[model samples]
Target: MDTRFLESFLTVAESGSMAEAARRLGITPAAVAQRIRALEDEVGTLLLSRAGRTVRPTEAGSAILARGRNILRDVRDLQALAGRGSIAGEIRLGAISTALTGLLPTILARLLAAAPMLDLYVVPGTSVELYRQVTEGDIDAAIVVKPQFAFPKTLDWHVLRSEPLIVLAPERIADRDPHSLLRSEPFIRYDRNHWGGRLADSYLRRVGIRPHERLELDALEAIAVMVSKGLGVSLLPDWAPPWPAGLSVAKIALPANAPERHIGLVWSRASSRIRLIQALQTVASQVSMDPIAG
Candidate 1:
């Protein structure tokens, strides 16, 4: 089976449009359609469901999507391994929103400068989602909040940053006690669905503070904006900077024992791109040490 055909199918499935897939693959749309048709014939099943401009994977296609990704990854790994001691080939990296906005640009810049042949494809997701992606071999590695649970032996994790939880309040109320403000003021709750947010929730529970709940969402920057506008105070990780500018908010310190949100890198132990992964790790370490990165 031609891997190019498989690539076309996966790209089409991901983009939900053959034209878009063709654009990404640098091929004509008609050629992309032909490749998909050939792949469907080879696989002996209809792989996509088409409706006007939109496309979706059929049941059969969905079943094979993960396997297809793995196959392509292995092929790429083989090609990279054949290279003459140079880090070359794509790295499918997943990152949480904060890491994407905060640390990723520096890491990417240094990695590319050191290994000019390397290519990158970045996926933005929550820590939970990125962890799952790494475990499932969908991505080479991820920068994410550390998981509360233990990981399997197939994966390796390393802590990159330890962000402490803090009370985010408008400057006007910055003088108020953190716990008292949480209990008295309207609360903009961090989403407990995310690992970082779970830390905040666990802290609130441990302190026995049932805040006057006002609103809740996952985006930390958005939460900050709300706090800046005096919508409510929030408990959040003091995430790495480049916060939205002109926000008049204060990061009030939590108690000495407040649970910290650990941001880290997780990767598959079995990935053939270990050199590239190690290079990325090194760059992340350098960035973490840089005072301006915070």
Candidate 2:
């Protein structure tokens, strides 16, 4: 069977729109339709049904979908094992911007060196967006903050790092208490929209400190820069190293009970790219333990 046809069919099934699948595969909608027709003809049954602008698999298509995925996975596994463990395929990975800046470089270098034939496609997004992409099968894996609530049963998470929430205060501030400083000084808030930011917010609420709000921003380095200039104090994670340079700010630890931000890799358990994800896990393990990440 033609794997290209199976892949096209799978992409369309996942996306629910021929146009969207075509965009993902970098092919025309007409070409996608032609391939699906060819596949259906080869199978001798209607594999899909058109519903307005979207498409859905028929009973036969549904029956074969799992089999088709297995076939694809087996083929790639055979190639990888037979070729001295050289993984050769395109993998789309999504990551939060913080991971892109702070952690992904070392992991990417190691992964590319191990599998030179692999084509890596990186998509930068927030944790929420990356989680959606992983769930929808748009990306094989993602590096993001672990959700506070229960995650879907279909996914697996591997914790890479746990960073404590910290207070960033200007050197001029004499106050040592995180809560007191927050209540007294102008606050450069970490944007509450992010998962990490939510951690900070929850901690603030628990500590009963309503900060004197001055600004709400997302970028960690930018927040560090702002605090360094004596703009305001902000609560943020003391994430791994390569921090913003020459920042004259004091990093104050929160009370022992404050929640730490957990960062890790997340992926669908049924994905065929298990080997690749394992490779990523290996690299992340090394990076997390490395002094540079601290």
Candidate 3:
């Protein structure tokens, strides 16, 4: 069977749309459909069913999905191992929202400059979901908050940055005490569902202060906006910023012992994309070493 045909079939199966798969593969929808038909003929089975704009794999296609991925990965690995061509292929990378906004662009620029042929497919997701995707091999790697639990043996992690937690309060508050303001003012609680949120929660508990909870949300920028509007003060990591413009808020430092939120890359050791991951790691390390000035 032609690898190109198999690739097209797999792409269509994953994307659920021939047009989307064609766009990703840099081919026309007609070409993608032709490739899928060729693949179906080679396998002597009906592989997909179309409904409107979407396409789903048939039982035969479903049965071979994992094997097809493995085959394609193995072929790519073989090419890399043989030094047959330039390092070029799609890399699916998962990342958290803050990292997407704050850290990744510089690092990505460096990586692209070094490997001009490489293609990156970035998927934005929460840290928890990114970690799961990394472990499950749904992505080549992920940039996310350091996981709270013990690391499993199957994955490797590297720290990229350590961000200190800080209190964000409206500038007009007369009292400057971090703890006092935290307790007295209405609190815009960080959503407890996030790992960083849990860290903030732990800090509050350790200090024996219970905030007057007003609202709980996950977006840092939105929370900053709310605080600027005098809604309530918030506890958040002083993550890399192009913080909201004209926000009238002051960042109050936490005590010396406050937990730091560490962002890092996590990847499966068994992945075929180890070389790409290594290249990304090098770029990330360089970026971390020489952070860009705001």
Count steric clashes of candidate 2.
Answer: 0
Is candidate 2 or 3 superior in lDDT?
3
Cα lDDT tens digits for candidate 2, 1-294: 788899899888878999988987888999999999999999999899988887999999999988887676576656545544556766678888778877899889988888788767677788988999899777789999987788889999998888899889998874578878999889999888899999899988987889999999988889999999998999998887778789899988877776889989999898777777777788888887877775
The candidate that achieves the highest lDDT relative to the unseen native structure: 1
Candidate 3 local lDDT, residue 33: 92
Pairs with steric clashes in candidate 2: none
List all candidate RMSDs to the true structure: 2.8, 6.5, 3.7
Tens-place lDDT digits, model 1, residues 1-294: 999999899989988998889887778999999999999999899999988879999999999998998899888888768763888877889999989889899989988999889978788889989888888778899999986788899998888889889999999989999999999999999899999888899889999999999998999999999999989999999999889999999999987888899888999998888888988899998988888665
Candidate 3 per-residue C-alpha lDDT over 38-132 given as tens digits, one digit per residue, 9 for 90 to 100:
88888899999988877999999999999998887777666546542555766788889888887899889989999987878787888988898
> How do the candidates rank by TM-score, highest first?
1, 3, 2
Model 2 regions more than 4 Å off: 1-85
Q: Which ranges of candidate 1 are over 4 A from the true structure?
A: 1-5, 15-46, 51-54, 63-67
Q: What local lDDT score does residue 286 receive in model 3, on the 0 to 100 scale?
A: 83
lDDT of 1 at 141: 97
